[model samples]
Target: MVSFNKFLASVFLAVAYASSSIAAPRPAHSKFATHRARVVGRGLQVEAFHPPSTFQTFGEGIDHPLSKRTESTMEDSAVAFVGSQLKVDFNTIAVRSGFSGEAAKHVFLRQSHDSIPFANAVANVAFNHDDKVVAFGSSFVTPNSIASSSPAIPLEAAIATAEAALGGKFNQHPATLEYFVKQDGSVALTHVMQIQDGEAGIWFEAFVDAHSGELLSVTDFVAKASYQVLPIQKEMLTQGFEVLTDPQDMTASPAGWHNTGTTSATSTSTTAGNNAIAFKGTQSSVTTQSSNGLNFIFTQDPTQAPTVAANVDAARVNAFYLVNSIHDLTYKYGFTEAAFNFQQNNFGKGGAQNDRVTISVQSSAGIDNADFSTPPDGQSGAMRMFLWDFTSPMRDGALENDIVVHENTHGVTNRMTGGGTGRCLQTTEAGGMGEGWSDAMADWTEHNSSAVPDFVLGAYVENKASGIRTHPYSTNATVNPLRYSSIATLNEVHNIGEVWANMLHNVYAALVAAHGWSATARTDPTGPEGNIVFLHLFIDALALQPCNPTFVNARDAWIQADVNRYGGANKCILWNAFASRGLGVNAANFVDSSAVPAGC
Candidate 1:
């Protein structure tokens, strides 16, 4: 009943004051330093945007502060637009977004760059302002361009210039985000944006289910407020250096699965039941068990993945490692701390009723290679066959783990949500969220398979034909290979798998910083905390997200996710985590959402 903006305003006040700078971030076992807020990638290149003597809002730069309360300015247009474009609760959501969090976004940019209009965004109040919802938004800020007074240009010029202003390309692959209300009674959009300062941070922009506002990808930039913008980026003030400075108490640029776990298998004994066995091929002397269920046939694949034979108690032990790790971080959001019981058969065969948690392990050399195609712009591996019902015998191991975990995610997610396939897929041939969720579950599983370093994937190595890899996250659907990037457009769990990963991936980074996770293989047994953190969030996202398949649904799911996980009881904890770092989540903030969600 309280307005969302009021909630936002209230939330921001707490966020603004809370010191987000946590202990310096260092891998739990790093000799480089225990906790350092700054991280240098392989080649620490100089940036292009230089810091101003005083980073203040637009009006501040020119002797004015962002109009003290400019909420109404956006409200006039923002509200009318939402009313015209949306039918759901925008009447109040608009009022809340337009106000509670409106001034704060301008403040964030103003504090960093001269107050100017931020372009292309989507936001959620991090806190509630005076009962209104307060949130954050992101955008590419640019200084005013010099006058080109030859002749007056058309509005398209504004569109072109506006596009440039936000640091976006007109020819972007999926193009700008387009919001729509689907016939299925869903409101969502595709794509969004992240204000890049240059190479300091350039995660990737894979895709955005742009049509329905499902973010396929966007920037996973995290920075702290205390640390000022980079020092060298001078001429690039007008053009951000593509870097996201000052990630508050977290890894701004995290690297996952760059290599296999130093976990060597060549020396392990050919034990049938021990997970310690090096799984290089289907013929490994692993488990040789058969299914005992009337509906399921389990076996450690002697020929391929479906390696149900070797992974009996070992897989469950590994699962316990994962579930226990999650209990340490954010799953506190779960109303029911999900069941982690293990079984070889019918993991979700009976639908939502009989299934809540399922675990299956893939012990094949081929599948372990994480055959997820090369990333950046990949096309193959798992996300392709999302449509399959997954019932073959060999489908029992690695593939089984993937399918079971995913379907199980749905069953658990149904607790809070009424239950239905999340957003459909861009490709009709494959299952939508089911596939995405499955793949994501695998990613999560592999991330936590062991408490070892390199929370990477595909350590099992199912096939030798394809080179080794940790596994690519999502597929483009249009293409055969898979692609990895920020959350932008989302069609299904698989289509939007990247989005969920991006969110949880960073959450893991935060947990690493928060709990001071061990870094190196010696001190940090679990690699990055993100692997475990992501799993914790998965159980939570599924349970709390709207039972529908819409980006807005997911967007709302995220809000609830944050509240249930961090805010409320730990309001100070989660909010300071985002805002103190300059990350904004507000309407008209995602960049792509401008035309779609339209800042409402």
Candidate 2:
């Protein structure tokens, strides 16, 4: 009787377990607890490990992978971390291959419910060389179970539905298959269609349900352009010119500019029309007025080549070369297809989606100053170097390499920071940083001798010993006393920017002092070992920085970028530079008017 009762009890226990397994969903946290504990053990403090809200301790620097961590092991750990919170089986989170930049040494995971990958990232994790968790960021969310696994409609049908909903004459790109996360926490298969309006400068991402062929969501993919420029032509001529050559010597003739005959224009569909345009091309001449097959000719006097047409031609040719050089230099430092760099050839692979910017070198720009506008990713961007004749300062904004590079860097910063969607540096602090970035690049490009770096902008145009800014940038606080606190009283973007620029100038100086400027600084932008590393770090920091960041946020991103790239070797130098500018470890609570760092 005892044996029979024991057998009955065992049978009852098995039945109860089986029923529970089939009754409801398993808790994701329990499954992920092990991975979470491991991550915590690695010194990465996190309040929660769930998706769409994982907050780690601020100021924690990401380091290089320790020698012990293998690539596969890091990936496995990342997958486990993501999977636990997602409550999904293994292999559900797909790490994007060749994912570098802010996600470098880390895995950028997308919720891969199906074979195809999604457009946006759900989570990312980085492991140090020791295979320890160094950094983790995520926007992941676990979905409630869907009723069906199969789609009722096909991909073609979904594309058609999305197109109809967008309502425009659009030139469609390839459709991307994805799983759309619905508002109700349910998942539906989707086709993400990227389309550009043929009639207007509008680009959008349309998400359509793969099963129902219904439009799931639509969003603008472009942003408005901000206009700013170099002013005046009269007084500019009197200024001691730096790098611009005489117009006669600046012609794009057979003997001039190493003429390559016909070259594809970098302008995008919006700027170049339905078809691509050509520069220095014999096939067609749209902008050039001369029959010499040259857009820029020096028929007029070289010294006094002041005609609007001639000056515009000179500006266009020079601007093209400068911009192209900037592109090539930046590309070498990891600004590739993923970074949304502007390239006409797309570097030979139809290149990931949006990759073009429109430039107006010389136009009836109405203003003396120059400006740039970044419309979304797929759409074309606009940059105009205006022509102005202010007797106070006569200057063709396009003629100055400093001005051109400064303006061009604006495009670079805008595209790099916000995933090429044109949403970056919108806040007061961020905007100031944007201007500072421009100035820093300008100074770096203009630096010829390492003897002493002159912190000046528009020197050729302003013709002043101090340039056009309030003061020449100096590491010495006494010479340029602007600090974060100055932002409060002087809320103007340019004024606030000077303080930021001053900090960067000091940083560059410090890096040069430490790393020794490279002798190849003239031809190569990345030359001067310190400068190259600095530029790379600066560009990488843009990828790491948050949108509309505060001064403190921007500073931290730079510090973290240094940690990621060089394993914090330069952190001390970087800290001193910021500290010198009154932005230090303890500096916080900045008011917009005059925000300064408290101390080192």
Candidate 3:
């Protein structure tokens, strides 16, 4: 009797456990919890983790195992490697786009559930010459169960909702259903569409919930291209201009600066071309054609203020030249068609086409400031240059090279980071870096030697020697004392950016000290100089970092970029520079630390 009762009790417990397992719902996927979570600006939580090792060597001189098996292409090998890393099937990983560069081949992949895509979840994989995985970064989320694949609301309704939210009209593209990963790590089905309002100076990629028809989020493509004007190395009008003929890099702009299509250059006389179109006040482009090709020179009165009417021709030409120059210069540093650069024709290269930059000189939009509107790939980016009133003779923003370059850098940094989505740098920390990068690029372009000097921005327009920022960028602590801790008290984006730019100034100085400087750094990319390495890492890290990266995440990406490109040759050099700025390995919680990484 005792043995029979014990057996009955055991059977009862087993049945109860089985019943509970069958009745309960499976837990929602929470891989994000396993990663480090930080609440950045705007109460937004981002999860990121740096693996102990970013690079893995399968065997000595051996190709990746996946590549060795069967006749596989580079894309095939990449998808297989990433799928294996994610513990998912390769078929589910979709290859969106990719580009092959001198150093490595980069592939952008997206995770798909059933047939729908994840709007924000993406992974960037790069392979070195040996077909080995050299670098990887991802924000991919695995879904346990999708509430519904079908949308309750129609596409038309979703478009209407997005248009209403943005106060703009749709760009005539079909809305697509995507699995959007919300900030809380929850997945929602959403209809994504693009809306543009040129009059309002706004362009956005808006996402609307599919089931409830609620507006989820919007990524503004229009970044304020604040400050305007164009120059060469000179940041202001005080530095005279040098006339450059056929300035376009043949390798970068194969069709030349004047041609937008495969056909040869045409001969009309406006500042319009494949890379940029310069006009003034609403669609009126200056039409002065010189025998030497689009050359219209004008004289400015040095003693008095200049009028926009008298200098519109020169301003338009300078603006045109500067925009095209930036396009070619950044292209050499890996901002190519495949990287979603601003180009009207891609010439069979990957990425959307028909999106050249539009330059509006003396634009009637506003005064004393400029702006650039960046839509996604295949849409034209617009730049509006305003007149500054700081001087007795108002200054044309279009004549300042630093201001123009600073604005163009907004486009480059926007497209390069987050896999060309143009939405990654929306958070306060990320947005601040955007501004910092613009300032740094401007500072870099003006430097022609290893003897780097403290740089000021908008000095000419502001008519102030101190420039617009609180302090000129300097490596010396006494000169510019901003550090990682400085961001604690900073609430505005530009102020936060001053701290970051100062840190980069230190990093730039350190790199120059370690290697050397290059005089032809602007046009030439094939050098062992510190400036070359700096630009390579600068562009490479943009793709390696996750969307909406913080200061630490960006710093880590730069270090990782060095590891992949230079075999960690500049590890200590980079860490020490960052450490000097209080962003060392031990730094945390916006606090300052002078410690370097253990190995360094």
- Lowest summed lDDT window (length 10), candidate 3: 27-36
- For each candidate, the alpha-carbon lDDT, in order, equals 0.26, 0.53, 0.73
Q: Candidate 2, which segments miss by more than 4 Å at Cα?
A: 1-98, 101-307, 348-354, 375-378, 392-394, 459-468, 522-528, 591-600
Candidate 1, residue 18: the lDDT equals 25
TM-score against native, each model: 0.31, 0.60, 0.85
Candidate 1: tens digits of C-alpha lDDT, residues 1-600: 223344334323422322232235632212101111111222221111111111111111121122245454434433333333333233233222211211121111111112111112122222222222232222121223311212132323323332333244432323233222221222233233322222122222222222211222222221101111111211111122122222211111011111112233322222211111212222242332222211112222324333343433233222222222222222222322122111111123222222112122342222311111101111000111111112233322223233323333332332222212111111111123333444444444433223322222222223222212223332222222222222223323244444443333344444444544332321122343434333443454443332222333344444344453334332233333322222224321122221112221
Top lDDT hit: 3
**Poorly placed runs, candidate 3 (over 4 Å):** 1-67, 89-91, 143-145, 225-231, 262-268, 290-292, 301-307
Root-mean-square deviation of Cα positions for candidate 3 versus the true structure, in angstroms: 10.9
Error of 1 at 548 (Å): 2.3
lDDT of 1 at 36: 13
Give the distance in Å from residue 446's predicted Cα in candidate 3 to where it truly belongs: 0.4
Candidate 3, residue 254: how far the Cα is off, in Å: 2.6
Runs of candidate 1 exceeding 4 Å displacement: 1-407, 414-416, 419-437, 443-495, 517-537, 568-600
Model 3 Cα displacement at 388 (Å)?
2.4
